[model samples]
Target: MTTTQKYAATGAWNEPEGATPRGTVALLPGRGETAASYARLGRRLAADGYRVRYVPVTLDDIADARAAVEELLADESLPAPRVLLGSDSGAALAGQFVAELPVDGAVLAAIALPGSAHGEVGADWADEVDARTACPVHRAVLATDEEFARGAIASPLPWETIAIGAQDRPTLALHGTDDRVTPLAPALEVYARAARTDVRLVQGGRHDVLNDVAHRSVAATIVLFLESLRLSPEAPPIVTGLG
Candidate 1:
C-alpha cells in the first residue's frame, strides 16, 4: 500500500519507496489494452524493487514508444539494464522495437504471433471475455476500459518486426496453453525464430496471462528473468529506423 503512484491522462507509473530499483520496465499495453489494466501488475512489480512505466498504445504508438523507451534508458534516476514488457499484441510491437532499440531485454506475454487465429466470440462475447482472463476482477476492469471495449485489432503489424529478427540479448516469450486469441503453436514458432528466446507456456492460462488470476506468478517469473540481466553491463546503442 506504500507504493508511490504517478499518473498521466493516458498512462500511469508505479515505484516502490525505500528500495532501490534495479531497472526500468517500459511496459506497452496491447491493442485494446489500457494502462489501468496493468495497475495491479505494475504495483506487484514495483513491490519487487523495479520501476514500471505503463504506456497506453495508440495507432502510431511504436514511434512514440521508441521515444519513451529511449527516455527511460536515458533517465539517470532509474537503474539499468532497461527492458521492454509487452502483452498480447504489444508483444508484436516489443519484438519489433527490440531489434531497433538497444535495450537489455524484453518480456512478451500472451503474444499474438504470426500464423495465429482469433478466438471465436458469439452471442456470449461476455463469457468469451471472461474466459480470456482468469481474474474475475480484471474481467470487470477489462469490460469497463473504453479501449478494451472498443476491441481494436493489432496495430502497426508484426510482419516487418518479425522480419528484422530478435535482438542479441535475452528475450522471454510467454503464452498460455489454451490461448485461442493467438494460440500456443504459433507462439512457439515465432519464439523459435528468435535468436535467444526463453519461452514459457502456462497450462490452463488464457490470452491475458499478465493480468489473469495467476498474474502474481507471471509477474514473479518476469522479475526473475529481469534479475538475470540486472547486472549485465550496458551495450551499444541500436539504430532506430525501419530495417
Candidate 2:
C-alpha cells in the first residue's frame, strides 16, 4: 500500500489505493513537536491501512487541542475502532481524553509524569537530543525541524489537569527502559491504575520510544495492539503459545 499525505499543518496520512482503512489513529504530539515530527510514524501506520492524523497539541492552547481532537474523532470519514495515541506530554493529554471521550482504545508512549526526575533542565541542544533519542535520523529531525521545541523535554507537565483514571477501554502503554526524561518506575505506576492495560518496554531506548532506534519494532508492536483491538477492546493476543 502506498502512503499519501494530506492537509497542510495538521498532517493526515491515508490508506493506500483500493485498500479499506482498518482503523483511525488521532495522535496528539508531545511538547514542542509539530506535525512534521511524526511523519515517519504517520507513514508507517498508513502503510498498514490505519489512517493516522497528527493532531497538534501544546501546553499553550490545550482547549483548542481538545476541540480539535473531538472534531477529528467525530469525523465519519475516519474508520471505526478509533484510537487516541500520544507520546510524552502528549500521552498525558491522550489519557485525559480517554477518560472523557468515546474513543475505542488508546496508545500511550513515553509518558512524562509529574514529580519524575528528568535530567538537567536548560541543557544544551545536543544533550536534549541525546536524551530524547539515539537515532541519527531522529536527532537530525530534531536538529533541523524549525517547528520542534528544543528544550521542551524538561518543561513541566500539568499533572493536576492530566490525571489518568482507570480506563474501561483497552490501553497500550509503551516506555523505554533507559529513558532519561520520564523514568520507567513512575510511568509503570500510572499504567498500573488500569488493570487491563498492556505494557511494552523498549530496552536501551531513550525518551522518544516511537522514534528510537528500535522504531520498526515499536511500530510493529503498535500494529499488533491495533489489530488486537479490532477484534475486541480487551486486545486478545493474536499470537499465542509462547511460554
Candidate 3:
C-alpha cells in the first residue's frame, strides 16, 4: 500500500500506490517557494512509477526541513536508497544534508555559483540578455535584482560549501545556458570544481528550465543520471509526457 506523510517542515509527501516501497526521492524547492511548487514534477515522477516526496523549506524552516528528512528516513514506513532532487537554493541545502546522511545520488538544478555574491555573475536576470555581453558584466546585472538578493540572504546553504562536499557524491547538475539568475558559466565552474564529470548544460533555457521546453530533455537526463548510480530500481520513472 502506498503511503503519504505530512512533515512539519515539508508540506506533503506521496509514495507509489499499491506497490512494495522501492526507494525515496526527496524533492526540495527553490528559495521563497514551498514544496507544493514541485507538485507537477512529483506527479510526473509518480506517473512514471517512483515514490516521491516534496520537502519544503521556508525562509526560516531550514532546521525543520533537515529534521523532517532525517525523521522520514528513520521511519520504517519509508523506502531505502534515497535520492535528492534539489532546485535552486534547495540544491545547495540538499548537498549539505547528504554530507551527513547516506544519500545515493543527487540532481542539482539552477545552482548558484561559488563566490557569486562578490563575483560578477550573481543570481538574478530572469529575462533574456544579449549573448555578446561579457559574462562578468551580465552576471553583475543579474545579481542586482532585489528578489534574487533577498533569496540569497534567506538561503541557509552556500554554494561553495555545498560544492566542497559534493566532490564525493555522484552529482548531476542541470543548468540553463541562458539562466540570468544562476548563469550557466559560474554554475558549470562549481560543478567542475566538485570534480563531477557528469553535468548537463541545457541551451536556450532560463532559471526555471524544468517547466520550459527543455523539460523533456531534462527529465531524460535525470533518468540516465539516476540509472548510473546502480543503487536500486526504486528511483521514479522519467516524465516522457511533455505537457
Candidate 4:
C-alpha cells in the first residue's frame, strides 16, 4: 500500500493497512535529511504491520517535528505500542524525549556515535557520501536530498538528562561498522551507559543502515526488537545475533 501522505511542511504521516497494526512508528530523519530520505525505511515498516509516520526534521524544524509526533500519538486509528526511530543526528533528537514521552520504545540508528563533537566533515566525506546507501540507485535518490541537505546538526550529550528512571524503557542503538559519519565506538559508549540497551553493528554497513545493502537484515532485527517491546516485561530477550 502507498504509505506516503501529505502533512505540514513536507508531510509526516502514518500508513496502516489490513488488520490492526502491530504498532505505530515515528521516524525522524537526520540533518541534511528530509522525509523523502525515509521512503524505503517507512515502506519496510509498514509492510511489517506497522503504522509508520515520518516526523519531518531539519535544523530549525525540531519544534514542528515534536508536534508531529504528538499528533500521531493522539491518532485514534493507531495502536497502543509506539516506537520512535531516528537516524544520525536525528537520533539525538529522538533520544531527548525518552522520559515523559508516551512512546514505548526507541531506536537510534547510525547516531552520531558518542564522541567529541566536531563541525567539519572528514576529508573523505564527499567520496563516501553515496556509500551510505548500499544500493547505488537508492544512493542516487538520496543525493537529491543531500545536495539540498541542511548543514551539520549538533549532537549534545543525549544521556545526560535521560530522566533518572527512564532507563527502564527498551532502547536499541544500531550502527554500521564502517560508518564514517558516525563512528561505531561512540554509539557503543551510548549503549554501555543505558539500562536495557541492545546494540547491533552491521558488518561493512555504512551510515544508512535503514537503506543500506543489508537494510533487510537491519529492518528484520528492528521488527524483532519492537516485537519484544510489545511483549510482557518478563518475556525472554530478543536474540538478534546481529553483532
Note the residue pairs that clash in candidate 3: 124-181
Per-residue accuracy of model 1 over 1-243 as CA lDDT, tens digit each: 333223323354545566777778889777667676887877778778888887555545457867766766676776677788988777877777777776778888877654334454343556557547878888877776665644453322434334314648788888888776776776777788887788887778888889777777788888878777864533322334575
Query: Each model's number of backbone clashes?
Result: 0, 0, 1, 1
Q: Give the Cα lDDT of each candidate.
A: 0.70, 0.83, 0.59, 0.67
Runs in model 2 lying further than 4 Å from the true structure: 1-10, 116-122
TM-score of 2: 0.92
Using TM-score, give the best candidate's number.
2
Model 3 poorest 10 in a row by lDDT: 1-10
Q: What is the lDDT of residue 57 in candidate 4?
A: 57
Q: Write one digit per residue (lDDT tens) for candidate 3, span 37-140.
A: 44445655555545677765653566787887777667666565577888877777776676666777778887644454322323433323232122443244
Q: What lDDT does candidate 3 reach at residue 4?
A: 20
Q: Give candidate 3's whole-model lDDT.
A: 0.59
Tens digits of per-residue lDDT for model 2 on 35-115? 777888888998999999888776767787788899888899889889999999889888778867778888999987865
What TM-score does prediction 4 earn?
Answer: 0.79
107 Cα displacement, candidate 4 (Å)? 0.7
lDDT, residue 217, candidate 4: 90
All candidates: CA RMSD in angstroms? 6.9, 2.4, 8.4, 4.3
Itemize residue pairs with steric clashes in candidate 4.
Answer: 114-186
Candidate 3 deviation (Cα RMSD): 8.4
